[model samples]
Target: MKRRIQINIAGRVQGVGFRPTVYRHATAAGLAGFVTNTPAGVLVEAEGEDAALAAFSALLKAQPPVQARVETFAVSDVPLRGDTAFVIAPSQGSGDLLIGIPPDLAMCSDCARDIRDTANRRHGYAFTNCTCCGPRYTIVRALPYDRAQTSMAAFTLCPACQQEYTSPADRRFDAQPNACAACGPALRLLDKQNMPVPDVADPLAAAVDLLRQGRVLALKSLGGYHLCCDATDAAAIRRLRERKHRPTKPFAVMFPSLEQIRAHCEVSPEEEAALADPSAPIVILRRRADSALPAEISPDTHDLGAFLPYTPLHLLLLDRTGPLIMTSGNQSEEPLAVDESELTQLLGTFADFALVHNRPIVRRCDDSVLKLSGGRRILIRRARGFVPGAIPLPMRGPPVLALGGDLKNVFALTRQQQAILSPHIGNLAEFASYSFLKTAVADLARLLQIKPEIVAHDLHPDYASTQFAKEFPAHTHIAVQHHHAHIVAGMVEHNLRGPVLGIALDGMGYGTDGTLWGGEVLLADLCTFHRVAHFKAARLPGGDEATRHPVRTAWSQLVAEFGDEAEAVAAEFLPALTEIERGTLRTMIQQGVRSPWTTSAGRLFDAVAALLGFQGEVTFEGEAAIHLQMLAATAPLPPYPFELVRQRDPWVISFGPTLRAIVQDLRAGTPPAAIAGRFHRTVAAALVETCAALRMRYARHEVVLTGGVMQNDFLLDLLHTGLQARGFKVHSHALVPPNDGGIALGQAAVALAKFFT
Candidate 1:
């Protein structure tokens, strides 16, 4: 009797060697089956003895490609016509299998073996790849993940590759990225204007040599561009800094391997595991004092963000005996260059040469960010290795699009509780950024087959992303408050339904009551959040200007404390406002030209940084705050002081005492380093006291500390230690950044909580 079974399998079935693996198993079991890709998933009709059929099915469920994920399976009887031998057929391209585009994978064992093997056809091949590993989402243009639908379409498979691709028994039987030296994407070394450098056999080696000799090379990478230079060369690094106009904010480093990175930084077991994961994201680990990288690479920073190679090209480039400063190749505050036109224009002055490639990157995703928390390593920005992929939501519901915040902006599209946040798209202000966001979102929607009915965005109207969301006329627009989104984001990442005390601090956000809020203590659930506590609101002379210029913020604080009529104001302000033109400072605060009130911890850190004279002028966002914490280098933390004042019968953290003590220390000529240490310690202590007091009232020790300000290592370390000593379980971002960039996930989570449970 001829027997047949129809099997439907779903989940990361595309671009991950799935069909080939299954075909190989079925054919070896002597089952006659035809496999085809449908929009919903893979569909197969197999006819064989019950025993062989069962065995093939078992192997499929138990062992498939390592990178592939199987979410569900359905099996049913189907009438069989006498069919001989299993055969993998062409994709049927039916059904909307919306869920399973594979995330870009790191180099697999097979590819790694080939890289290290001198006799292998792909020996030392920079673009070597297999079905199980290599760029998937980054290289993909359209769906079905066929070679014709990818950036690799330009390179036709050679005779050997074609044979292997056509044979079910071959490892690359269904590999879409299958290519050899004779046929595949090849690397090209380009001169200053992106002209191909003629006659170079090992361009990677030559590029490394140029870098070792102190020349900057702008290398096109798996995602976008990277500004590469020897990490150990300070002069070379400084030259990069001058060229890129980036004076701090700690650049990311790319180590050759996990072992080398571990030797440079103290990697926890979890961090090591994440580093070795296929994604190979940039994981922030505590820096070892003896690390070989120059101090300027991460000046005044305690932890160094590092990663191993995700691409074979990176592996080939890093085969040398050292790490490279793999910083983003762009001028400050611009999106990374992906197109050749932009490369020549944006990175023109920065790099002397451009490593070019013919492959087209339809979308650009930066390498993901990561951190270790509570003995676990988790993703911060889920990109490169983890985009176009969906996070499981708590409940199933209608589709929604969440346009996240302005800084580090990433958006999400949701179907049910599952939200697929696009990989870090960028600031959302630049024209290129807006276009990237629009195109990537549309691609994700097309792949997932989702049509959003509700659109979520931050409350600020000026946000470029928010404005973009309004263009979606069909969706019901919903504006999520900045801190509310922050709190809900913490709740979503922690998988909590009950209310939790969330401390959402950042540079600035519009409060519901029409004032600026940064330092906020909120008792929040996914549904709503109550403003429970906050930092004292101080005057700012021109709101945005005050943030960029911290001296004005510090001076405004003094004016708030002593009023404009008070005497000795100059002497008191002079200690913190060193080098600020005194006449102009007093006039701005008194006349209130740009003076508005703000209660932002991020701004407070800026003011403290300015007061310590670490930085009076900020060229970029977060510069002042970054330098302020760096001043804590070796300063012994002094006694931190703060008072809980009743503002309209609600508790508020008063910076008056904090400011007074800082002034007293400055008048006495205390070391700026000590002042920085004291201020950080003081703020951390205040947070502990405030949150603990709230904890006593609410009976919840689980406090979530989020927002961009928490990225400050000094503040994070102090707050984590202070709160732990005081007996509170603290939760910070691990799965997502604690910054505005991660706001979309929270918005989706919050919206789902309302729409679902």
Candidate 2:
């Protein structure tokens, strides 16, 4: 009984050796057919005995290529074509674009071995790559991912490389980026002035020597450039920080192996798995107390962002230098440098020399970042190794484009039931980052060939994303409220269509009433939400200046609690503030000059931190709060007392009692660590109590925790444990970030739901 079948497969099926795997299995099973890449996915037509065909299908299901993810597989019987042998067919460009674009992958073990073997032809080759691992999203210029459509199109394959590429059994067969030293892109060493370094026998070795000498090198990577320096050299790390103008923010360190990482950071099983996963993201881990790494790498925190080498260039450099600080090559708050011009313009003063390659990066992507909270891996930044892969929507909807919030921006495009989020686009406040956002939106839309019917953006009218949405051509435009989007983002991740009790906590979001909102509780579904409960509001004196200097916010909190006595309390707790500064701040609070009220849990953390002896303005977002968390980690104190004023429609969780207790503790000479721990415990307790009450009133046992403040692992763990103990289902972010980076997904989901409604 000879028969034929046509199989259509979707997902990450192209540019990952899927065709070769199919060819080998079909030949082994004695089937005659062809496998070709199509706009929709991979299509295979096989003609053979029923038994052989069944075996082939089973093998494909059981053993897909290492990097291939089969999301959908359909097989149907077709009339037999009496072909003599199996063959790989050319890709088809017409049809619906449904296939997943492969993200940039880390170097595979086989490729690593090939680059290290002395006798291997690819030995010491900086651009060595195979089907399993190499640049994908960054180099791809168009779809039906063939070599001719990629950055590799410029490099004509040499004879030996072409033989391997044409051989069906070879791993390099049809691999778009497949190349050897003779034909592939090569590296070049240049000075700060962009002139080539002459007489360099081995560029990689010279680069390593420069690192050992504590010189900063701007090195091109799979996605973008990284400014590199030896991690152990305090002077070098300090110099790099000074040159880059990044004073206090932690830097990601790339180690040669997991063994090296284990020596400096406390690697749990979950953290170890994430560090070695195929995506190879930078995993945040707690540094060991006895670690010998220089403090300049990560200041004011116990955690270190560490990762294994994801590229041969990084591997080669780290093999000689034990560890290197691999921070993004960009000026402060700008997008990552992706080309020579960008490198020189952004990192010219910072980098002593540039180690660059001839291959052009079609797109710029930063490294993805992750951390474990309550044994669940959470994405801090989604890019590079984990982007351009679609996340399944709860239901199908029309194509929609969502422009995310202004900070930690990431955009999303919806196709039927799938949502494709763009890689991390830095703060949209900077001109370079904003330009990158526009470019990324256009690039992703063109690649997916999606013409969005609806455009979604944040409710903030002043955001660049919102402004762009106003001008983007679409049939419909939606304005999604900031906190509402945060809650819905968590619901989308969990595939929930519920009126869940949502706790949205962050620094600031424009409220519906034109005030600032952050600590909010809402009864929300996909489309709409009702304000249920919220934190008591406090005046933010000096507007944005109060955020930069937490002491001003602390003074405002004191005034809210003790009125005129706040000045005397400020003298005792905030000695850093001068008497004149205090008098001026009082006038600001009294006259409501440049002051706005906010219900922000983030601002509360800053106030408490200031009261606990933290001084001076913060250098980065969440710096004061992060310092408080570090202090809290050292103590295990019970929660301070809090009050829930339930007389209003939307009840208020007041921190007046808690603030008074914190002041009393300071007066009693209690350790700052104890006060910090108590403050954290108080916040967790108040949130749990509010949720339990809301669950009883609304009969909704499901609770969602989201927002940038939820990134605090310590608070998340407590909230999760407390809610679960009270017999409620608790959901937190795992797939996408809980910060504004994940806002686009929520915006898209809400817009689609509203469209159907």
Candidate 3:
């Protein structure tokens, strides 16, 4: 019997050679079919013998293109049209936009081979790419992702390249960015003043030479520009850091191969997998003690952020230069430079020369970052290879746009049950970052063709995202509490219908009571939450200034614990402060002037780090805490004492006893490493105790751990282990970051849940 069937597939189906894959499969099965890209997804109509059609359908479901992720597939029987040949049809953009745009993929093995083969047409080509791998999200400008809707539209394909793109059997079939050296984006070398460098025949070679000569080169990459220099040269690294004004923060290193990465860092199976994954993120790996890399690459930490080349340009450069320090091409907290004008305008002072290209970047994306904990990769920064793809929501709702928090800003747009999060937009405290946020929102919304009915934002009124949400055209607006969003984001990732015991720990968020909260325990579901327990608050003597200087927070903590004796203790342990400065801080704490109380886990870590002799202001957001986590050595130290006070409805977990014990240890000459280890254990134990009690009272066993503080692998590992041992089902972030980068997803989820209710 002859039968026909039509199949509709969604999720990462566009711009990933899905139509070609379908054509090949249909032809191989001796079935007549036509495949085309639609706004909703890939649509295939096949007609043949029933057995052949069944086998073809099975193959399509079982095997998709390596870069394709099939989230939903539907097949239905259709009347036979007597089609006798398989054909790839042109894309139609009429239906609903339900398909996910493929993220930027790393260079595939075949493309790598092509670039390395001297006889290949693409040999030594910096922009060599096929359907398997190349720029996707960054170059894409509109839906029904054809070449005309992309940045590649400006570049005309040469005759030979056009043949490969038109051939259904070729690997480059329908590859939008497919090009050869004959007609493709070419690289150019420019001086610091944005003038073309004379007599540079090979820009890649010139860029490599400049890097080898200890000069900083701002090289345009797949998503944006990166400041590059030799990683092994301490002086060069120092010079680059000085020019960029990034003194102590770590710089990611790009190596040529996995073998070289293994030489400098301990690559576990999981870390190795992440480095080689298609996303090609910078994976945080443990540094080998005997390795000889320059200390300036990563100062004050035992971990190194490393990644392999994801683009042919990067591969060629790394092959010639070995390892280069690859950092974002922008001043400290500004937006990434995407085009030549922006690059020269922002990074002109830092780069000695610029390696640019003619190809435009439709959207700017930074490299994603990941760290391994409990043998799983946790996202530190989600961008590039992992974005523009939708995260499936547990329930469907009206369209919503979520503007995330100010720090580590990322926004989300929800269509039906899929939430599309924007790539990392950096700190909104900077005007440039805020502008980038707005631009990103507009671009992503247009690309997805969604005008949100509801707008969601953080409760913090002063956040740029919140302010934007206020002005955005939407039918409804909802303000989600920060900690509640953190916990709910984890819940959404795990698809949990919560009312779970939620542990939200981070730097600080505007609390419901008009205070700042971080160390909080809440019983939360998607729409609502109840704050059940929290860490006792401590005064931040100078408000925002106290966040920059850990010593101020430490002194305030001491005053809260030791009273009048706090000044003597400060004089002994905190010699970094002068007597006059100490008295002024004391008066601020006593008189309740500009001081605001916070129960932040990050502030707690900062205070302990300061007490352990880390003086002065932090160079980065979590510098002191990261250093403190690194200082903690493995030991079975007992936890410090803490008191759980049930003096009110919402109980307080007081660390006053723990502070006194830490002081006593400091007085007893205990090693800072041991104290740090003990402090971590104490925090883990207290949280476990709180959750255990809450589970008994509320009858909820599912516990979620989230927030910026959860980025600390040491603390996360302890909490994961302890909670599981106590018979609680624990969940944490893996796909999206635990930091504020994932806040938009939670905000979207909460808004949708509330609207549906």
Candidate 4:
């Protein structure tokens, strides 16, 4: 056995106090070594017996930073180069390879208790951080995490603080965000007119008073500024809605704790973990049987999105009672406030009371959304406390950046085999969202320090991001078809670098052929994609008017597929629509009056929900799809009535079989629950068969499912389990949402492929 051992620890080692912890552990074990921060990670050149080295290695990994993730360690035999003492060296760059950056974490329980304790020296400290926990991604600047390269640089260490920072045995050792009342970012409460409030002894008390009085307050947070109010009070929620000009979109809630959440809504073990994660993202939970939250929260739904505290400030704010309505601090459709000028310009009149802070937000990151399904935490929106760090693409490619689609926009930068997706901005149509996107794109590019050879964007000419991509005159701008990007993303995630069939389904995307496309099967390659099959063209009778009001889709489906008699017979589908709307829809379908053609699965979901008398008005995007998936959870195993037929030499799935089944169910007056469940199961079964047939010819080729439709658990589980059982490898998203939320990853991936091509 080797007498001496050496090891290189990598992944998220910098910006986190990795080396100090290493020294503490090594010295405690009585081993002579030196730990130095490398560009890649930390290198511990230790002189010890093999047995002792083995034990030290275990101890190193077992007690890593709660915020920092240790991806790997390379341990090997070393010649005796015995050092007198274990020490932490200064920071070093990790060559060309991108370094891992840890996400911001919630304040540790110890630090939290100290902050709440009035007698403690660090009482009410907002930036109280130890090596084990507190701001990582949020406060960091450059990596190889040192005091000088973070926001904490402004605060010189007091003598006591210096001692604690130097002592490895102490928790604050090398904690970059470490500070006390003597030194740190200060807070100032402001009135609506941009003037600081005069000597308010208790800002929290004032904030609570505003909340209780049904007044809106804009509070700056770890991620960004948020507009908060009492969610339980109807009048307050109504006032917030009017002030923000967001009539119906559901707002996220922050409760005191898990027990408080359980009191309001029913949460599964999976959902509880997601809510309690360091990210503290908005998690969708089922409403309890005795649900009584304000209707304004989930105006047209049965579930509520909830989150726990992720910051010391959040904990202090939640110390009192009522559920707080914490929504992004921006006007309707705009990105959350990040910049000082923007905050003053947009929110000056929107909030009655404004809680401001001096710390600058280098970049804006929205709170990530998550759902726990099948006992695994699935990221729906990879933002806020979880972004910018590169995730290795399963396949290798060159560096490039892709500006994502128009809605729920996120951008991505790819280098080597890793793709770093930028945080969620917002809908790009709004000027604030567009500006945030612009800043974030530049930020990631600067952070990675990569000059891109190519820029990728959606095929749509109207998307603001696409327009921005064209402005890069020197860079090669590749306009990828919207659906093709979706296809390539799925394939790239699975490392399926070769040509394969792709099924891209969603609400709408600009097709390569210049018509709206959604439900499509395409023959896709890295260079190009061909439309091989698609859902039968259906008339969107009211054009864009049909989206917010889905009953039009239901009416059109009836008239186009089952004739006028079916339209008259289907009263349940027409509930949301008035008599005039019903008459107008009938006329539009019969005459093909101003109808836009679409094959969107999202629209189909809306139609299905309308037919079953589920949700009438959609407060948010995918509202219908989300509720439909919930209904589908009650569905059982049954054969779907769908036929794979060759239409004009291309294989297409005929919804005719499924539509007929639904019509028959309507005639028999089948319960909406049974009908909705059967529809979900049927679609899943059809997809499995489609992939299975294709795989038979290719002899073991895999299937990768993507798009917003794949966000449906009922459909996803069906395809995953059913396809796997039939001996085919199935790939779906866990890190990113399958929806347009992850469009940037696909865009970046495709852009990288073009560089190699």
Candidate 5:
């Protein structure tokens, strides 16, 4: 008997060769059907033998394209029509935009083969791609993800390329970026002054030669420009660092192959998988003790950020040169350079020459960074191949947009039951980053055709993201507490309904009591949070300057612990401070002027780092903490003592005793590594004790660990074990970062729950 059915499928369906897959499946099954793209999803109608039709339906679900992720599929029976042949019909652009477009994928293996195959027409082509892989999110400017709606529209397909694109059976069918070297975006070699290198014959080869000669080259990449230099050359690395004003923060490296990277760093199977994945993020891998890479690549860190070449241009360049320092093409804390003219102007001082391409980048995205935690990839910076993808919400609500915290800024826009997070927009402290945030958010909203009804932002009024949220006239404007957002983001990532005991630990967040909070234990759900217990507050003298100089934080902590006697301790322990600076800080701490108290886990780490003589001043945001974690002893140590002062309902875990013990250890000639390890253990113990007590009182066994402090692998691993052993189902971030970079997800989730409930 003949049978007919209509199917509507959604989620990561468009631009992923779904219709072509369906067409081939139906034809193979001997079913007459038509498949077309609708705004909601892919729509298919089939009429054939009932057995064949059932098989076709199963194939649609089971044999989807590798890149496609089917979220929702619906099927309904219909009266059979007298259709005799299978056909891929024209798309119907009638319904409102509903489905998510897929992020850009790294170049596929087939394309790589073609690029390397001498007999292939696209031999040595830098932009060779098929339907399987190529630029998607970066080049896309509008919806329906067709070639006409992308940056590739400017470059009309050549005759031969057009034939492959039009052929339904070809791999390049409907491949928006399909192009041969003869009629594709062209590459050029330009000097720092933006003039073409007159003597250069082959631009890529010249760029490679320049890199080998220790000259920095700013190469235009898939999403933005990357300032490249020979990673093995210490002089070149030092020069690049000086030019960019980046002193000690680790720079990411791009090796040609997995074997090459494995030679320098220890790559576990999980880390190797992430490095080779299509998203192609910079995976943080532990360095081999006997490795020979230049120390300047990753100073004061045990791990090296490494990734394989994702683009053909990168592969071509790597084929010519060894590992290159593939850092973002921008000054420290600035937005990454995207436009050719703007990049040339900004990177003039940083690079000797520019290896640029003519293809326009519709949206600027930095490469994502990942680290393995408990054998799972944890996103440190979610960008590039991961951006603009929808994260399913726990519940549906009115459209809401969340402007994340100022640091590690990322925003989210919710539609239906999914929240689409924008790529990592770095610290909003810089005007350029703030501007990029605005433009990127606006572009995403426009491209996705969404106008949010509710706007969510941090409670901190001083945050640039909060100020941006104030400008949204159409939104309801809800202020979510910073640490609450951190905890909730973890819950949202795990898809857990909370009322969980959330341990929010980070550098700084605006507390509900008009103070800064980073070490917080909260009874939290999606809609609200209650501060149950917290670390003892310490003064932050000189405001933001305290973060740069850990010595100031140490003095403040000492003063809070030992009164006037702190002046002597400061003089003896903190030799990095000038006598006058010490005197001024003591007076500030005593007078409590321009000194805000913070119960920050980050500040405690900073104080311990300073007292142990690790680093008094840091070049990056979490340098001291990172170095402290790096210097810990391999074996476990007995934790330092901490006082749980329950003088009030919301108790305080006083680190005064711990600080004093650390000072005693410093004087008693204890090894820095031992002290560091003990300090870490002490912190983990305090948090575990707090959560165990909370579970006993509240009877909630679900414990969520989140915030920037959770980025420390030692602390996270310890906490994970301790909580689970105590019969608690511990949840921490896996998909997104535990840092402020992922707070936007929590903000969006909270806003949705608040508005709808």
Candidate 6:
């Protein structure tokens, strides 16, 4: 029988103790072998009795380490050579670098146990991690994931720890971040002036006590710093809000455990699984009606963004502080602070104390945000435990870079059958966010060793990302239409090819025709898309000004429907509107002066929310729409009337009937909640009917629902359920965000298709 075999394993093998596991299994099978990490992937050579080798191979495939994900394992025969023992050879950097980089993982159970055990050497160690888990993407400076190439290079292992590193039986075998408290990074408490605090018996306890005192603390984490305070303290929460300049934006909380989370909010099985998973992200859970959480925590919202501790430091702090407001460690619209100097400089004025750590965070990845859709997790903002992890492409193409849209910006770099999207970089309207965008792109390219031949960007020239794309020298820059990218992203995410109906719904996008587009129906594939239908055009008085003040948009809609009679009705609905502002808005809409026409579904929600007297001026991007969706009742209601008129090539879906019905309901003294519920159902029914009509003409049943408006779980649930009931194959985003955060993936995928197909 054959006695020798060589195997090549790819995908998430380098940083996950894969080679050590392979060596142990081979030795147990009495096989003389050696395994090593290569630039491409992991390589192993085994020589032993045929049966023993067979068992070894089976073990490698079936019983790999918990963190090791073997996507491709290939075996080939090799000539037998007598060898003494199995060994994990030193990693080789030579080869074409095509390996998948592992994202930062949560601390494993073993590490957590060691950190908690009183007798263990690593007891109370905040950065305790084994080979199976810990920072990877955040600590990594280059490929071949060795300690020498990471931020941990500065911390050498102690003698006793070195024994664990060399022992195959030990959990810390070949652990890149392996170290004891004597040699590894240490925590220190610093005042606002960046000087270490005096006479601190325990820094962690001191930090917790500070938090208990309702003081804002800037605490260092694996990826970056976080501004933290007691979540239940209303005064402290209000102070943080004022300091961060984040008036109405909801803050994410870090609870100690699943039991504690269940105590506050309604957590479904799906949400529980997500919270308990290795990549512990912030899961937005629906708060219980009787929840005792302070109103200031979520302020006018039904859902709370909650996450379990992903690190030992967080665990320790949470053990002392029941729950903490753990938000990004930066001012509003700026990139998250990573370095100590940067954190101190940016947060010193606000944070009462800085809980600093010496463990350098190479990359600044913010906490990821997600929620459930149809019993499955949907990412809102992909970061921290999920960044730099490549999404498999349908096919390989020339390397390309795609700069996403203005809001919720995320860029992507494409390579052979994979697209690695950047973490959420906020809006590019701010200089700091724009700067982060540039650094993220360059850092991704450098780390992955990608030289992009083609660049992709949005069609809008005014977008900062679009402008950034143009600055890339010697690259072919392709401008993808904003809505087209939104639709195609859903297609690429689901690995769909050929034609599918795409319902692109969001706030606004730069249309190919130059008018603002949001609500759109398109026939899309990887290469291109064709707009088939859209919402009827309505003037956005004062353009972007109409977005912040929903009353102006409501006035625009009312003027579109009732003309002069709209003023009297508008006065009744929007009591906050000043007559002078109302008159000016009316004149702007009538004269069409700087009033850009838009077919935006988001605007419709804004108008409806304004009509229902929910919000006059939005404090956040989707504040009014989010409030409207939350106010909607679970009981199903009959949809309001809407018209699908085929007056032009692409039929216009008019909201005139819906607006008129809403006006009547408001005059009839209907509850705003009832109107909101009916409005949501109406939008869903209208979209479903439009899809049915499109199906009759195109005969395509698969519809991909995408865009920022799809973030509304109420509308998404209704639309997804209604569309599926009509015998249609529906696809919505789960891996990437439905918002512009996912636009880069679509852009990159399209560019690859155009070049290769």
Instruction: Name model 5 segments beyond 4 Å from true.
Output: 1-13, 21-66, 69-84, 91-100, 564-568
Stretches of candidate 1 off by over 4 Å are: 1-98, 373-380, 562-580, 631-639, 647-649, 665-678, 695-702, 717-730, 751-757
Between candidates 3 and 6, name the one with more favorable lDDT.
Answer: 3
Per-candidate TM equals: 0.86, 0.94, 0.95, 0.92, 0.94, 0.94
Candidate 6 off by > 4 Å: 1-11, 24-64, 69-84, 89-100
- The better candidate by TM-score, 3 or 5, is 3
Q: State the C-alpha lDDT per candidate.
A: 0.78, 0.89, 0.90, 0.75, 0.87, 0.87
For model 1, residues 321-440, the per-residue Cα lDDT tens digits are 378888877666567778888788744798877766667776687888878765544455678877767666656767889989877778999876577888887766666677778887
lDDT, model 6: 0.87
TM-score of 5: 0.94
Ranking 2 against 3 by lDDT, winner = 3
lDDT of 6 at 419: 89
- Comparing 3 with 4 on lDDT, the higher-scoring candidate is 3
Local error of candidate 2 at residue 495 (angstroms): 1.2
Residue-level lDDT tens digits of model 3 in 1-757 = 9999999998777767788888889999999979998878889999999999999999999988777778899999989899889999877756565453688999888899999999998999999888878998899888767799899998899999999899997889979899878899999999978999999888888888888899988889988889899999999999988988888899999999999999999999888888988899999999999889999999888889999999999998898999999999887788899976788774568888998889998899999999997875689999988887779887899999999999999999998888999999999999999999888888888888889999999998788889999999999999999999999899999999889999998999998898999999999999999999999999999998999999999999998999888888889888898899888998998899899989999999999999998887998999989989999875888899998887786889999999999999999999999999999999999999988887778999999999999999989999999999999999999879999999899999999999989
Instruction: Score candidate 1 by TM-score against the native.
Output: 0.86
Please give, for residues 568-633, the per-residue lDDT of candidate 6 as tens digits. Answer: 987888887878888888888889899999999999899988888765568778998998888888
What is the alpha-carbon lDDT of model 1 when measured against the actual structure? 0.78
* Pick by lDDT: 1 or 3, better one: 3
The residue-by-residue lDDT of candidate 2 on 1-757, one tens digit each, is 8999999998777778899999999999999989998877899999999899999999998988877778899999988879989999977765555453578888888889998899999998878777778888899898866788899999999999999888997878867788888999998999888888999988888998998999999999988889999999999999998998778999999999999899999999988878877689999999999999999999989999999999888887788888999999887768888987888864468899989999999998999998997787678899988888788888898899999999899999999898999998988999999999898899889988888999999999899999999999999999999999999999999999989999998989888888889999999999999989999999899888999999989998998898777888999998888999888988888888889999999999999999998778888888998889889953567899999998997999999999999889889998888889888989999999998888778999999999888888898888898889999899999889988999899999999999999
In terms of lDDT, model 4 sits at: 0.75
Model 4: per-residue lDDT, tens digit, 237-302?
Answer: 998888777776678999878898999888887788677666678997777868677899867566
Q: Evaluated with lDDT, which candidate comes out highest?
A: 3
